[model samples]
Target chain A: MQISQQQRQLIQLFRHPDEVEFSNIDWEALILTGRQNGFLARLYYQLERHQRLEDLPQYAFKHLHSAKVFADAQRQQAIFEANEINNSLSAIEISPVFLKGTAYTLLDHPVAYGRIFNDIDVLVPKPLIEKTEKQMLLYTWFPEPIDEYDQHYYRQWVHEIPPLKHASRRTIADVHHNILPPISGRAPNIDLFTQYKIKTEYQCYVLSPAALTLHSLVHLFFEEDFSKGFRDLSDLHILFSTHYQDEKYWQQLRFLAYETGFTLELFLACHYCEAILQTAIPFTFKHELVAFSPSPMQLKCLNWIFLRVLQPSHPNYESTSYRLARLLAMLRGHIKKMPIRILLYHTGHKLIKAFERGILGRYSDTSSNLQPQPPDKNN
Target chain B: MQLHQLKFDDYIHKMTNDGLCLDLGVGVFRFKSHITSVQQNVYEMYADYNITEDKPADFHACVKLAKGPRHYINPQVHFESDVVTPFLPLPKSQAFPLLEWGMNWCLSAYDFNHFILHAGVIANQQNEAFVFPAPPGSGKSTLTAFLAYSGWRLLSDELAIVTPDSLTISPFVRPVCLKNNSIKLVKDWFPQVKFTDTATDTTKGDVAHFKPPANSVKQINTPAQIKAIIFPRYMPNVPVTVFKLDIIEASEAIASNSFNHNVLGEEGFKTLVKLVENVPCVELQYSDVNEVATFLQNEEW
Candidate 1:
């Protein structure tokens, strides 16, 4: 992607906060863009590392410092929630593998520094999925009260169960049996992932280095939404950079991607990271990964679409092409997830619900409730 | 420059495009909207605040009227920032309320430099401010409107941003929100005070905002030292009474009323402790605003 000068500056500051000077930067746009990409706190933490506290601009320093404080509190809360889940599921004889954000925090990876996460995703053995759900129910975790259609979709087609929320704490957990949906025809063997799980200091399991990178790749590239594209791509950059120093890491990543039927995901991750983030990769590996790329015409279209979609969705950077590209990406995601018939049924149902809510004015009354409450059916 | 200084057409054009950046004492906000009523409200309510032409803003917000599916059936207004929409849409007529609510949301949600309290603040001529840390319907707004129009300077009627290290309260001189019966009461008590058209059936029940005194807006950037913290409640026909609260009680009350105390963590705790330790805390219960106002004006702290 040919990022703008502002984006380039942001990337440089993100990578080497200690080296970049911030005297002449546009603080407003930088803060807005960082916030849009979920990197405001991360940016603040980086700047804090390199600059003296007294030298910073008052407005910039105060906001960033405040963000850092908030990030710390959220991180602590996430850890506490993870520990609670761990203690709850201890009786099931199945250790939950913390995935993505929670795993990053639990393992204390650099990526977790100043990261903000909403939900905890955990994976379990396919055979133990049923037992784990029952155990969670005993511990007061229930499947979020989604409607019948969504419940059916999750149970019959998706890789994970309907997201489970604790009754009191309201922390969400998604229990997954595979990385990709079974209906998507790309679901990898559960054993391939289970074999690489490693114990962490906190008594939970996280994916091994190679598996972690591959999973992040699958999560980022295979997902339909680009709302968190920049943040997720940053995660890939951090993981690759942290692990790439080991000579064996590259080979292991390639071998694992091939074994898990996710070589395309890994290739795209490497391709974009190298192009956008300037992540270093061995020349031979870059050339070798090209063999796993899609056909030339499809590759060209995808590259054009993804480059637009991956950029921060700030208005200052957005264009009509980007909006169209996002739509194309969403369509492509649905196509990749299910066969045409099921896709049509699902899309039709959602469209009708939207039409009813919008056109028919089914739920037009506005309530005066002031306190924040969990979203209910009426909302 | 101020918002009213611009021609109505120019103000609408700027607001619809980039946004009209207004300095709200503690912070700057860029507000964008295409709705004519919203524009008029801003012009009337923010006529005294500073308008930034090319300067950088601390926050950007917009009240976008709902389009497509829901527009024709029942129009709605959405409160959005550059990053996310914090709340669901409301009726289109409530755009002004949505703008105020959105601005408050931005300050409370994003501005972390200050320990924010859901309180009303009014200052004396010496710049010693009294903070009323209370919840909704606690007569805080009534007392604030009464004091502001009577003699005291209205710093802010909704938000009080106290610096964590210094415990100095920064001024956010905006309109005082008066709800339901208080709207009539304030109008009756202070006939000279200007108010925007009352919004009926609002979430806060027939809400109207009374303009701050001109002197208060002129000294918007001035900081004030905390003189006392009072938790006020209104009970009809109850004898007007004031009870002193200890440091622990005051700290707990202030913390509970704070918006970002938990997010501030240890710094939040320390700031609250310092505020409680140095200031006298009291709870005043009364029915009449004048009775509470007289007591507050005469009380020696």
Candidate 2:
């Protein structure tokens, strides 16, 4: 994948935050591009860790200060919401297992330092899914409105229920019964995943170290869109690099991957992390994972597509190949997610909606008629 | 060099490719617009501002016409930053106003180092500033226009960016946004003042922008010290009166009108408190701009 010079510098700083020699770099372009790709806060966190604030140019320092302030507020809000969720589910006696960003945040993992997310994702036992939704509703979380076709699709094929948003705060929660959809024919056994859950300091449960990495792999590799590819892949790098220091961790991860029908995902994750981020993997583990690698032709094609799609989705760095590769990857993702009949129906419905909306028309003119008003005096 | 020095063709070419960078007091804005109307608006309104040739800009803004089916039918214009579209498209006729709104959004949204308030600010020759914090329909813009022409320097008509460490308010000398009946009122009051073409049926009713005094644009980099905070309310057919507000009440009111006070957390709160404690606070009620202007002119700290 082709990356701009500015992106390369950002990645270099991410990997090595202690080196603060930025005498020749263009801080203006770097800051604007970082903000564009939603990496400014993360970059600020890294630089702050090394106490390199004084080294920044005046303009960069001011903007970075602002980004840091926003990131701190977001972190505090996420923590407050986590506590609220815990209180809401206390009656059911079923501790919701936090997934992805929320889990990392609750566990105080380094990967969560500057990360910002829109929704909190949680997994529950399949039998308790209904009870969980009821509990959420009792706590003022209402299900968002969905059209009939999409509602049926989620109920029949998706792993999660329709997303629920808090009535007052508008925070979103994705309630799931399993990590992957059953229609994919590769859903991990719920009981097996539950066996590996560990309690956090906050008294909520999170996936064990090996389960966490494997689930992240499955989530990223099986997705139809790459809008979040760069951020998710960075999470993979941070988690793997942080955990691989313990020999026991690596062995347990490999064992869990094979037992859970995710060896292929594990292989691709390690391959890309090393190939793209240049994350250091032990020679022995790299050799061992090669046994589960795909065929040579499949490996070549996957590498080409993942490399392009995984780069930052900023238009300044994107190209014709990037768009084509993303489209092809989307098709492959749909194939992996559903059977032929379901895929045809879903794609057909979406195509009709697109036609009716006239392609580029995401919003109706009637909706745009709402005028901007000044903020209320009492607000 | 100033933007006015560029030939129209050269300006369009630069804007389409590299961008035409303008130093806008607090930060430099690099703008690229394919629409001719937007270009003309910038040329007229920003003529007094400095132009940066190859320097880096704090923000990169563009106003691109919508493509595909909507482009040919009811053509729309979109305001874009590098990666995000902060707003929906407006009709092509509103491109210039869209540019103004977009530039204001970029400053108020991204410039987090300052404690930004939805207020009008102006200064005396001594650099003593009065901050007017009000919501819409408060006649803040009309009051500001009146003062700017009556021996007061127009600091800004909308955004007031106050530095946190030092409570000095930075000037953002852009055009004053006049809404509805205020549009015609301002035009009648200042017959010599230049305004962009009025945009009707906008979300803010009928909208137009009053150009800032060229002297204000020339001295944009000047920062002003706060001497007073005034909350203005306009009520028709009422005698003009000014009431002093307690320090606590004034601080709370100013903080509520700030754009990013919550994001700045404790520092934001402390800055506002310190400002209110040091400056006199007052609330003024009036129906006539002339009366409000005279009251401000006769007041002493």
**Candidate closest to the true structure, highest TM-score:** 2
Q: Which ten residues in a row have the lowest lDDT in candidate 1 chain A?
A: A370-379
lDDT by residue (B1-301, candidate 1, tens digit) is 8776888888888898889999887888888998877888888888888898766788878988877666877788877877567776778888887778888888877887789998999988888999998988888988988898888888889888899956599998887778888889989888988887888887667877787887888888899998989999889998789899998888889888888887887888889888988899999899887787777778888
Deviation (Å) of B212 in candidate 2: 0.9
Q: After best superposition, candidate 1 residue A162: deviation in angstroms?
A: 1.9
lDDT agreement with native, every candidate = 0.81, 0.81
Evaluated at residue B91, the lDDT of candidate 2 is 87
Q: Which residue runs of candidate 2 sit more than 4 Å off their true CA positions?
A: A1-3, A17-21, A365-379, B246-248
Work out candidate 1's RMSD over C-alphas.
3.4
> RMSD, each candidate, Å?
3.4, 3.0
After TM-score superposition, the amount by which residue A146's alpha carbon in candidate 1 deviates from its true location, in angstroms, is: 1.6
Consecutive 10-residue window with the lowest summed lDDT within model 2 chain B: B80-89
- Compared with the true structure, the alpha-carbon lDDT of candidate 1 equals 0.81
Clashes of each: 0, 0
